[model samples]
Target chain A: MPDKFRGNLLALAVMVCLYERPMHPYEIVLTLRQRHKEESVRLNYGSLYAVIASLLKRGLVAVVGVERQGRLPERTVYCLTDSGKEEVHQWMADLISTPTREYPSLAVALTFLPVLSPDEALRLLKERALSLETRLVQGQASLQWVQRHGLPRLLWIEAEFLLRLTEAELQYVRELIGEIEAGTLEGTDFWKALHESQELSLGIILSEKAQYPEETGIRAGGQGTAPRKRTRHG
Target chain B: MPDKFRGNLLALAVMVCLYERPMHPYEIVLTLRQRHKEESVRLNYGSLYAVIASLLKRGLVAVVGVERQGRLPERTVYCLTDSGKEEVHQWMADLISTPTREYPSLAVALTFLPVLSPDEALRLLKERALSLETRLVQGQASLQWVQRHGLPRLLWIEAEFLLRLTEAELQYVRELIGEIEAGTLEGTDFWKALHESQELSLGIILSEKAQYPEETGIRAGGQGTAPRKRTRHG
Candidate 1:
């Protein structure tokens, strides 16, 4: 019932692992790695014990017993309590159900990309396409491995989501690159002027249609007409 | 240059605005809001001044002059420095070009969903589908508004990306719901036994194939034959 556990993915993963049965922190780590849950859960081995301890204090998990294996150190095994089980379901439900606001850094960057010059933008975007190409190849290989090993769809659905997003970025960037190379990108004139810090008439407006509030419509000492209409594919 | 400004999206936006011409912070805020950059740049009005101060100290921006409008307080206008112009291009380039590690919370939750019972998962997933449906509707309206207003594609590309992603999530969630309702989810049997805490045999392996290292596999005191092969659509 405590709000502290909310959004703590590691704690959630820990509880989920224990739900299968009682597990020592070491086993939890190994299970997560072997299952390839590593992509989703970024865990610190040292902090995992701390996460389990906090769960114990919160009564979400109970220390069922200590186990010793073949000359190894004694490990405290933990089990998910009934409350823990309920919490996992509710937490996962909230997480998967809700569309939260996330500030993906690349998304933010792309939104403000007009700040850069066309050539510079093209150069960097080319770099991006190359990076994405490499990543796509790697992603394809890993996805195939998941399929080859016959893992459940539930296990690697996130990988598919990531792959889709990466593919989208690549496609968009490549198209933008093509537009830039062809000198057909929307607002190219305005962007080029700004990129070169060139002077223009007081009416030269870069934003299409002058749709922004008049007060915020930066005159920039330019008398400019509206930029050309552009579509997403344009 | 320094990596300090690599993730500073707000500063980047501010400088981008200033690159158009000298502007007061109020104008910067208005421009960002008017341009709908608020979705990507999370800014605190009070902290805008602090960000500007930091940028000034870092020589990315320099104050030009003060302007008084209609008895209002004289606002100090700032312009992007030459280095600032260079920085914006480099920063934008680096951001657009690099694929950073993003910890999307939804992706993390789905990876560990084995914690929830099939029924609970279905219930939560239904809730998710409903939320996504509402979001998809809103996103469609917003996209239409952007198109109707004749905003350039560069301005709303991020929104387009977001809408696409939301659509994907909705589509995937709906498919998952269908599978769950039909009682045909790949790991349903394995998940159900764990959900009910029922004893399963080793022959009842949850995954379609037993590919995990033996040492890390959770025996759970039951033998599981392999679960069925399930595709993303399955």
Candidate 2:
């Protein structure tokens, strides 16, 4: 299998559609939309054509037949070759079996979290918790609707997994917020003190300048020479 | 406040480094690496310089001084402007509080799970469960090591969140595998029957061809014309 087909969900979806029966590009689009596979796989006409052309070149799909409907353009139908079928199975297996490294935005955010003031951090986190709660409720309702329509859970299992992930994040975020609010989070004092000292230092600088006007002028003049020295070096 | 900086983790990391104090690019890189931030943020010297340049152009970082050590080239030291500090806080808050949509590969795979045989899916999922378990153990050990070093949890909270997500996914995959094995998955019967019927049809077709060679020849001859007819249309 080519590397392009290995991790390409859109290509995998196209192949899976062909697995059931030969289909033209239009039929494949309709089937994917009807199955709501578009939610997981990015679908666009240009990319679909590009994928089909690539798959054809790779011998994963064969041009089975062409059809015409009155004055319409000829539509080339395609079917998965044996190699394509094998690729689909192997690709799906690899995706399900492997845990690849992914960088979630939230994880990146939390890693540099000390950038925000503690109070502001708490406020933002609370907002996130609320958003997650709303999403959980919406996800639950959507899943229940699908169940009510007699759709099998297997078909919508991705949604279930996503909901579970969201629930876990919400739980973790809530606990973190609690720890911060209770002043028990590790390094909370240091994080808080860092900001406090910044403010204190700023205040001290202002007060000292106000109290010693002539001395401040001499110091400012002396500091001004540093930039001139840098200019000379440049 | 530029959209470019909104979700730019590298830019955020750079700004946060300057928030500490004025530092040249080299010092910023050294600081980020010393704090083990490269694990969460993608860092490359070229992109780091590009991010710094963008931040400088946006007036978020000001060149505070220039430094030269021995024969080394002069390095411009940068510090965050007041606006830069505000942007950092707002960006961090937005990232922490916002629950954006992300497409995980596993979720995409599960959406198309029916593409594989139930047996294969179960086997692959079991492998995933094992991998997740091993990762969980490794992650725990690493976190313990950091804790033993007396590093605050706040510094490594992203790892904690990642571990929690991994645990959630592992639990879900295991349950799915169990349901499939026990024949309790909602569509297990349908899924199994689909593959079985495909195999049965192939067997029947082969047996029919052997038993009625004359009729099979006619069908093959008819199918042979399909390509010719398509060629005419082309």
Candidate 3:
């Protein structure tokens, strides 16, 4: 993998475009947009030009020709050099064959689940499950639309991968919610106890703050002190 | 939900820690490490201090006291302000319920999988399957170790979430590899033909560059011109 192209999918996309044939930066962007590659790769005119310049510097791509259409400025056509072709293959191989550690935001939230009351956590998980279900339906519809139109699956395999991930996550979250609802989730009692104790202390603090609002910075609608009456579940 | 704390999980983590009790920056780091929260949260002394300073500036946390042990400088103990407590709950809820679009590198690679030949893609997918399997095994073993030690499920639920995601990806990759190997992957023939035509053209270009190495900037080991003989599979 080329060091210059690391973590820059736009660069890879540009090289892939050039590998098909020589194209100006604008043409590359248009082709990518036409193919809807932007769904996976972030694209912008400035970054596209920057990626092209870096590729040119690395000799992964070269100027083949320039095109000027009417009032438009001359756009330099770029073609994939041999090194560029090699780098694309090696980089794709590395990406496909290796599993790098990624910190998903959901994982971070789950790590601190105890911070939220058990009931609140359960409510949030149910909300997430509903959202995931909506997305899965939409994703499936799009995948089917592409297939019905006779578009090759290879073009949208990434969408399929994302759909599968969402499905797994939704299933996990649903099961977690079930466990909490059934009072079977380990440490539910402890989690509830912890929240109850905190609520008791918070009640005391809120009463004191109400007496001396100025000293505690507790202005109306300022300190999120809305009453949070704990609701018990069967 | 605080604008200042958006996408800043460290700030959220700090607030969660202070919710337990007021602690100096060093103690916060120690507690997070002890709980193995670093597995999910990126932790560093520098970043932790920066997050603390930012929280202070935002008034999400306030210095409550200072402590000095021996010759050490006074360490300021910070507590979560009322707004900070409210922010943590809102942030956690938002993160759990909202499914934000994340650009995983694998998705980007899959978008351009056609850049590699069918045989190469298959080989790389098989390699990926092996790596995923190894990780799943290690992840399961650790999760089991935690369970065996009587650790609360709440503490390691994030690890479980990650393991499920890996399992899903591995299953999808294996199915993809199987389809490719069986010659049933959509557009396999087209993909093969595309690569074959490119290989033929590449052969011609390589020979041309080899003849005029100086003109094309093809130096020894500089231009990645290593022969790539097409290997057909059954």
The candidate scoring highest on DockQ is 1
User: Can you rank all candidates by lDDT, best first?
Assistant: 3, 2, 1
Pairs that clash in candidate 2: none
TM-score for the first chain in candidate 3 comes to 0.76
Better of 1 and 3 by lDDT: 3
Cα lDDT tens digits, model 1, A172-200, are 77877897788776667666786587552
- TM-score for each candidate, following the candidate numbering: 0.73, 0.74, 0.77
lDDT of 2 by residue, B1-234 (tens): 755556568888888777766788877776665454565676678888888988899899999988887999889999989999789777887788888776778988898787777888888999888888888887787777767766677777887888888889989998998899999888778778767765523221111112111111111011122111111123
- What's the count of clashing pairs in each model shown? 19, 0, 0
Each model's lDDT comes to 0.69, 0.72, 0.73
Q: TM-score of the candidate numbered 2?
A: 0.74
Please give, for residues A80-196, the per-residue lDDT of candidate 2 as tens digits: 999998887888888888877666788888887776778888999999999888888867876776677666777778878888988999999999999999988887887788667
Using DockQ as the measure, what is the rank order of every candidate, best first? 1, 2, 3
Off by over 4 Å in 2: A2-8, A21-30, A42-81, A199-234, B2-8, B21-33, B43-83, B199-234
- DockQ for candidate 3, please give it: 0.24
